[model samples]
Target: MKIAMVCLLSCCAAALCISRFAIPEAAAKGSHSHSLGYRCPMHPAVLQDGEGTCPICGMKLVPVTASGPASDGSLAVTPDQQKTLGIAVARVERAASSRMLRLPGRVTPDETRVYRINAGVEGSFRDVAAVTTGSHVRKDQVLGSYYAPAAVNTIQLFLLNTAGYDRAAKKKSEGSLDGENVDLISSNLQQRLIQFENLGVSKRQRNEMQRTRRIPDTIEVVSPVDGFVLARNASPGFKFERGMELFRIADLRRVWVTADVFPQDAPYVRAGMPALVVAPEESSTLSGRVAEALPQFDSQSRTLKLRIEVDNPGFVLRPDMFVDVQLSAELPEALTVPTDAIADTGLRRTVFVETAPGLFAPRNVETGFRNGDRVAIVRGLSQGERIATSGVFFLDSETRMKAPASGATASLTSSPDPTGRRTSGGGAGPFQKSSGDMQAEEAAAHTSAAALR
Candidate 1:
């Protein structure tokens, strides 16, 4: 009787333990078997019970399905979520086009064509003829004349020496002098004549002095070249020493257009490239070609100097005139994207690539020469890949908010419950919920409990 009673009590205890634990296990199994849902990371309000993305933010939502084998399958985002995320896409196309680099420059004078005239001798301020800066003069044109006592004395002495030489020559030729005297006199006169000729006494003047028996004291200075007088330093009566600069003349047929290019861009510019020069005060445009590239760089501006040669038949281009120069070079065809597509973060350059509808992944890219509105993609991308051209800023912000591995894990979590807390339910896992949603949920729950009570 004691054994039977003990066995019956043990069986009852066993039954009670099984009932207590088995009920909860069965309930948990049923709960885990239910399908899970997900919500968009960008738009927490959007919820999906299937495998898909959030319709609001276009981000894949966390799956409500349990993780275990018994748990419902993971949620797959529907196409509707893709449309909500404002996902933009572009198709890559291969096209042949040349990239152009433009650089700013200025107009200058050709060094070879410019000349400066200086006073050969001193004496001036008697009169002024070529007074203005831009006045044109010709070769041998008398710019002005001056009277110097030293010059006058030199001319008179030259005339006197010539007269003595002519008389001595006449006497010798007429055979009126002895052989020794003739030889000596002839040699002496020849030396004096050569000296006078070396002093710039023209042959015509010498002949006229011999014929008219007179010599002019005043000296007339003539221009050497046919060009516009760029500068004037001599006055009618102003006395100047030898070799002093009196005028400057330049040939305007050819001019130089100098441009300053950034050191980084200097490599692309070379001789023989086409350039356009536009004066600040004129509407006309001048065309020229790059003649040379200076080896030195401007320390102050950190720019390379480029010289271009142009024709100035109209004499419109002037020295010291500010001008605008356009230099262009052709680049080979390359893969390019809109400039706005790149997000420069100082350390790295990033771009958002749309892997799917409303689904973007941030990718680091290397960029190259940038044209006006487009930039060349040197690395990190292939042709035909969809890239965000416009609205990239917004996409970048959204991408930053998600975790680095969010693209893979976003569809597996649940939306957060009210009060920013995640509920232990089988619906979309609590996504990051805004304060407004939390407040609304709290108010609704409070009203529901009050009504039930």
Candidate 2:
């Protein structure tokens, strides 16, 4: 009897142990199991298991799988799956810097320094003394001579009258000895002399002609100032009228570079701003300050005209020559980034910001003025943030592929009903049961099982 009792105790202990372990195992069997895997967004051929990102794009790993098949025939992606893809990225930074803007412009003569020599009387061109267009001449230098018979005859007549009046004044003074008559004769002589001088006859020439009893035929055309001759219109026998331009001279010691800035940029350009001008054909650069900005906009080009004065003592800068102009101004300090780093999609501008290792999030940004290689960021970002500078398009494509398709149907399951008829659950058909009903059934099954135990 003792042996049989001991055996029964052992059997009871074994049964109890089996019941405890089997119940837990059976309960766990009803629960769903999942596997983890990672993939590269750019290269789908690369796959792995881990909590890391794609090697190519640095995008964080998405959950390997969930409960359904991916639209592209791959397993469903869970929140923890990591995908590696190749990509390029850059870090945002700040430093004291200046922007350089290059523009094409031309060199022009300063209006204040250029001189136009015009004809003073109607006559035929006799000779051109200053032969070349760029020849330098001093003030009062005889440029050319012209023969005007009408002017010459008028001067001769005036001189002859002056001589006769002088003789009459002397005789009146000697004979009358009357102060009033003598003063009248003297006044008449002075009037004739003034008339001759008004006709361009010099005082020295008048005295010599009066003593010699002769009048010069040709009139000398003199330069008004010391400058280089820009143009000459006289020939050996060219006829000229009064007020006709005969020559054009300009002072080359200073030149002007006229820049045609667009109306939109006119506000930025102001007088007294420093600018640099580069000749189109020469390597030398000239520096100057903005002298003035014309208020009116060009009717055809719609551009604002700005003048910059530069010294050209060597006479190297020529009028109408083309040049490159650079205008710079101090700008307010602000956040800036490479222009290539931002992705512009017409409607919106965005940049992919690095949140963590292999993790990036798209951020919309507002931009301001743009310099040569960089642009000012007005909003939506801060300094010292890592952003994808190059190859962002590939990452974007991968993100789209990983996202779930909208309006897609879920998978369905079939099971036997109490009446032996097959019923379907979790599908896109009209007969599909509501998700709430499924949850309720799962809850009831757990409760009933617990009560039975």
Candidate 3:
């Protein structure tokens, strides 16, 4: 009887131990199995309890792990995952900034240095040098000679006046002519000399005429300045009327480059701003400055015209030649970041800021000026903040997935229901799941809670 009592007690103790541990262990295992949920890796919006392919993207669904979202709606990504996604980060800082503007330009002669050769009287070229357009000529170099009938008459009148003045001076010296009469004759002679000089007679030629008291057959046409001929209308025995152009010359020691700047960039460009001109075909670079900004934009191209002056020592820069112009404008100190960091959604601009290691949050930003590769942050950001420079697209997509209420995420918060009425507050947004999907999510939520417990 003693042995039977001992055996029964042992059996009862063993049964109590099994009830306390084995039953709860089995229940917990069952709950964990029911708590598992599947989600598409690419399309996180697609969630379901059973494992299958995503209906939208056709990607294989993976089990959704029990990872909780951050309290501030920030998304946490692992270092390994960030590496796989190619995320790059940069720090925002205040510093001196500048922008480079590249524009097409054309080389032209300086307007102030261009000269047109014309005779003041009717004439015809008796003989012209073999010079044509682009021929170099020096100062006072004889380009051709012309015969003007008008010039001959003026010279004869000047000689007659000179004779009368001499006779008056002789009489005044002999005390026969009065001072007033001699002065009047001298004045008339001066007027005749002026008329003769106006007839294209140089000072040397006038002196020679006064000494010889005769008229030359032809007046020599000479270049007034050293330059290259831009146009030549003179030929042997070619007749030209008064005030007609014979040649066009330009001193090409300095040249102007006309650059067409976009209307939006016109504000930054001003006179005296430094610029660099490049000739691709010549493989040459020349420094220049903005000479002037045209008052109006082009009527056809709608671009503001800028005149840049540069020196051409070897005549390398020719008229009508195309070149590239680079203009640099200094910007005031402001918070700036790489241009790739900002994600523009048409309605708003957002940037993914790395709040902590492996954590990124979306921040709205007001952009001011956007230069190539960098942009100025006018507001909604501060210096010393780290932002994602590249792979922002993935962060943006994740932000929308994790935080639908984040205003700058650009995810719509409302959609029309079956009744054609729009509802606010996360009601079937672009990425939101349907009612049927909500049922699956509900089941997954229960499973997640069970797993957590």
RMSD of every candidate to native, in Å, equals: 17.6, 20.1, 15.6
Q: What residue pairs clash in candidate 3, if any at all?
A: 35-447
Ranking by TM-score: 3, 1, 2
TM-scores of the models, in the order given: 0.59, 0.58, 0.70
* Model 2: residues with Cα > 4 Å off, grouped in runs: 1-97, 153-214, 262-265, 280-282, 295-302, 354-359, 382-391, 402-453
Predictions ranked by lDDT, top down?
Answer: 3, 2, 1
| Cα lDDT, all candidates | 0.59, 0.60, 0.72
Q: Against the true structure, whose lDDT is highest?
A: 3
Model 1, 118: alpha-carbon shift in Å?
1.6
lDDT of 1 by residue, 1-453 (tens): 645533433433332222222222444465635544554333444444465533222233443333321111111223443343343468644444544545566655677766766554456547768457888777667676666555566566656666666776787788886567656665765765575443434455556666887766655555666777778887756887756776777777788876778776666777888888887687778888888556467899887777888888787888777778877766657788888888888898988776665455678999987778888888988898987776555445444323322343343353343344222332334455565654544344344334322
Please give, for residues 129-162, the per-residue lDDT of candidate 2 as tens digits: 9457878888777788788776776666666676
lDDT of 3 by residue, 1-453 (tens): 645533433333322222222222344355334333554444455555466654533334444333334666566666765675577887888988678899999999999999888777898889998889989999778888899987877778788888888898998899998999888888888888777555666666777778898878988777878989999999988999987888889999999999989876777887899999999989999999998646457889888778999998788899999999999987778788887888899899999888998788888999987777888899989888888898776666555543422331222223223332222232332444566754554344344334322
Q: Once model 2 is optimally superposed onto the true structure by TM-score, how far is the C-alpha of residue 106 displaced, in angstroms?
A: 1.8
Error of 1 at 223 (Å): 2.8
Candidate 3's displacement at residue 39, Å, is 7.6
Misplaced by over 4 Å in model 3 are 1-51, 61-73, 78-90, 164-190, 193-198, 281-283, 292-296, 345-348, 355-358, 402-453
Q: Residue 423, candidate 1: how far off, in angstroms?
A: 20
